[model samples]
Target: MADLQDDPDTALIAVGGLDDPGPSPDKAPKTRPESGAQTLEQARELLAAHPIADGYSGVAQALRESVLYDLEAGEGLLETDIPRLRDGGVGAQFWSLHVPLELTGDRAVAASLEQLDLVRSLVESWPEGLRLALGADDLADARNCGRIACVLGPVAGPALGDSLGTLRAYYALGVRSVTIAGTRWTQRTGLTPFGHQVVREMNRLGMLVDLSGCTPETMRRTLVVTNAPAVISHHPTPVPDDVLRQLRANGGVCMVACTESSIREAADRLDHVRTTAGPQSTALTGAYDTGTPHAPGLGDVSCFPRLISELLTRGWSEPDIAALTWSNVARVLRDADFVARATKSRRPPSVARLLPPLDA
Candidate 1:
């Protein structure tokens, strides 16, 4: 609840969802136009009229390093999805290596590795249009070269097993960010002693701590402990005022999701709810059962343009929108990368001390 009224600069605008990479146009299911088609059409018109300038090449140099966070495109993403991102002016995206919370221990680690392999393979397949970005400088380089930069992020703390060594190994394998507590609150409560240790380790490794699926307590505590800026990659709006202020103070970001559910909530057409059952249940049910018309899913990257238009309609200035979309998050990435490079010789903390006691 950073005041959007008196402090226009602090309004946390909800951006679009993680890229979904839906079926290719040829394979897409046929359907009638939906309710927001007109709005979407208008948005496209605006984008065409005011295309997002290519960083350095366009009017907005600050936007050159723009990134799309929390993209859960997983293994289903295809060669076809690349063009959609390029056309939307997205220079970089953080592809989520999301292992389901149900798959713990070795299974979780294996699933995560497989997902990472898939993302690397996909980038290799489209080398001309895509490149694997390990740090912020890589993202900027990709933008300069006109390629879509892809970064790796693992969702949930369990994916690292009980070892901080495994976490460092993940960084060695190319993961730059981590969702500390996934959609469920299982591993360690954010306020707990063990959770603070995890946050500290993540900071030492230069890994971005994503709070997208964390509980309120977890988010608040993580903010207090994290040395680098955290991100609520895809969250609902009308976020509590206190949380907003805290996020700003920590220099974190809450990327407003552009999915049907998040859009409805931001528009005051739906109510927000906390899900206890995890991602599958939340995906099946949504923020609220308001029966609101479904907006286009993440597969259609066109949603970015529509979101931009929507923000403009609400009187958001160009600079504010640019900062939310690119500048702020880019700053976090840059700082994290600098730390990762500087701490090349630092040893990771012991796994025994990092994990909490079974009974505790």
Candidate 2:
């Protein structure tokens, strides 16, 4: 493990969540604020306004397949948010079962379960618009059926305690991914010996190991050990060059987050990295920091259309944009799901501990 403090360039970006008051009762407006009513008409009139060779339909199709898999959105999303997600062209969303860094042991596990229950309840309430997706196939089915596939993921590994059994239990409970570290570095530093074991177990269990919150050194090391491709659910500040290189080699995806600071910082850096790493190694996410005054009105799922437009303006080809918006993350999800199914029967029960008894 490298000493992160010794390198100023490796410093992580500060990320804090506001107390989400949950979604409002009001329905989302029919049109986006950025584009206005005229822009809405333009989208509807795409075929009439543009020549078929202009590729307007291609961009429109890409948006329809776009999946906001890593929302990091907790219990704040109300029933009304469902329609907003659909309107945003989000085919699927992984609502993060984020356990606070302050939680540990049994409390962490309990909190995670509660978050899961909340998401399930929300999906149940809106059966027409939302479906609980357990795997990549479910997501595809939901998209084909014109429904949003909602999935669950834990934001930190501590939610599993130190028990491999607890980890398997999460998988059984429909948690397809686990962020190895939370937002705080203390929870999972680069040198933490246990982090390596966690990655290996996650690989064996066919769970996605998310390195979004991990320190650069930790992310790099985990990438080296993980057989399955990992996802950086949210991009960190001062992006690590080596991690980008490893991600491309390992066939993982780095999701560029949608926070004011994240977007500003990632703009120049991501462009440079993509030139060498290839677009397949990168994806975009709406890590919507709800309830935060710092980033007012920027957390909406609707921001994705604007992002797509921006990518087009930046000279990103249709295929590259599609890969960033849909296929790359889709591939990772499918791969993880396949591994989980293959390893399910071999998974040991909680009592079949990974470590010997402390007393022994």
Candidate 3:
């Protein structure tokens, strides 16, 4: 098995669930009486035009571990719920089909599949609030229907169990993005040949390549091998300036996490990224339930409007905020699909041989 070196601090964060089945995002406006209340209302209006498309989340793991949480009312201790996400103006979320590093082989595969099932079930249970986003176009449809589009991905590269077939199976099952989330890939340095094969296969399958928590070396290597846009699902921090330049060149967006800490703190991080790499290279990730150290103020999914309001107060224009919150992710997803269609016409599915698993 290959491990994906992680740099979560600079990784592009990606996704979770929304609904209305027998279990989803629309309602009247919120009238919070906090300070700077007027700017907050403006920010909410802007988000109404360009709602958020959060790139990553680990809430599925949290959800899996807990049995008492409710998705609609958010009655328990979960970081996200339908009202909060809608209040946050979230239009899409990428639920992570996470397979823990501690699990390997069939166990990892089972975990991945179970998480995938869990995400789908969440969407199915609340079709009015959450819709499974199978493609980039689905986001707009989800928004039109007043539902949060739920996308899927697995940061654990080993979740495929060293099998290209499993990758395809995941794609078929709504896993649209993949990251090298392991740490000891094949007991080798950087991505293995099979790993490169995995990247190409994902490209061929029209899936986005995630670089969340990947080291610069691994990130560079993956960048070289992948043609479709790759994202850095960062924990709301900027990467090295040079890597930022390379990522910009690749037309990839660095997903700045918003649900990590105080609105002012997250704003500072977003401001740094926007200044360092320009707004075109930025997107928002809720960073909910990612298990990173948490802080007070603006920490839940419902707080995105407040984050946007802070940016507005800082002289960040509405268009730039829209790009950060929505358009960048939409463009990345569209580009990946376009590249896959053209690439698939020229190449067949990968048939690479999986190497023997190495001891951890």
Candidate 4:
């Protein structure tokens, strides 16, 4: 990660949130990448008209660790804040409710609720900048009102504790996604029988099955059972090319993370997704506030246009870039909602549970 403190994008450009707002950086002189001045300008126009719908962020973890660092204050300690997200052209953002993998059973569930509450508080504190979105409709409503739509989710699947009732409780509480994981997560194994039931329940409830850290075989197996589309949320490692192809066939999006040390690597990673998975299957995420966002080009959330410019230089068409930034993710969410409505007629809430229970 390059030192972004010296970058014009962050240093010169003013970015802060309400109650401690900085001078607006909107009029600051822009940096022209090798992508050319014309392409960069075009990128700005594209994002302005249709902001990106990011798939993952870890701000909850940041809030959990800091009592002094405030998102509303837009402190220097964090990669994402309201003002930067405003400048970044993020219309909709999925905020990860982080429950550490080490925390399991009821403890994991409790931790998830605490993190979710933090995210809710963060959004509620900034009604002017953020909106809690329960579905695709809410995402659009937030955008129309000039709010960054906040989609909440738990990054650890253990939060459910293998209880279908608990899954329903999460859905009722506005958790639209959950990262699939377990002790066997690292193994090249498919989902077990209970896992299939969980997938079914998620489909019926319209919750997204996130396959961020899932093994290739597990992803494939989940795809086999999932009626609603899935997402490969931001993960440290690159997704396999084969998995991208499968996700495309499943009407899913693989959110390419921009958590790289440099903007060039992030752009290349996104481009790789385009090449391997086709354009419609590609989307963007910064994995911001996860301690990995370090590029000067993407020093913070406000630098989305920089990434868009680099993509243009790589020969991505304007429409394709627009879809990648907005339409594709929107379509996935809509499809999930539609499937959930349809699946409800065919299936009821599942009664499945981990037979012996993992905690015991």
Whole-model alpha-carbon lDDT for candidate 3: 0.74
- For residue 66, model 4's alpha carbon misses the true position, in angstroms, by 2.0
Runs of candidate 3 with Cα error greater than 4 angstroms are 1-35, 183-189, 235-237, 259-261, 357-360
What local lDDT does model 4 show for residue 325? 84
lDDT of 2 by residue, 1-360 (tens): 111121223333111111121222122333343544444343323212210100000111121223332222423332125445544556666667765568876898887787776666657766778787776678667777777776677446767766667787888777878877752222444634455556656766768888866778778767666656777775446457777877776667777655555433444454665665567666666654322221333356644544454444454554554556556666777666554444445654324334533675
When summed lDDT is taken over every stretch of 10 residues in candidate 1, the lowest stretch is 55-64
- Taken over the whole model, the C-alpha lDDT of each candidate is 0.51, 0.55, 0.74, 0.76
- Once fitted onto the true fold, the runs of candidate 2 whose alpha carbons sit more than 4 angstroms away are 1-80, 182-194, 261-270, 289-299, 340-360
Error of 3 at 250 (Å): 0.4
lDDT of 4 at 307: 89
Lowest lDDT sum, 10 consecutive residues, model 4, at 13-22
TM-score to native of every candidate shown? 0.67, 0.71, 0.85, 0.86
lDDT value for model 1: 0.51
lDDT of 4 by residue, 295-320 (tens): 77777788898889887776666667
TM-score of model 2 vs. true structure: 0.71
Rank the candidate models, highest lDDT first: 4, 3, 2, 1
Alpha carbon deviation, residue 20, candidate 4 (Å): 40
User: lDDT by residue for model 3 over 180-267, one digit each (tens)?
Assistant: 6563453234587677777778878888888877767777777666676788875334578777767766667888776445768778
Highest lDDT: which candidate? Answer: 4
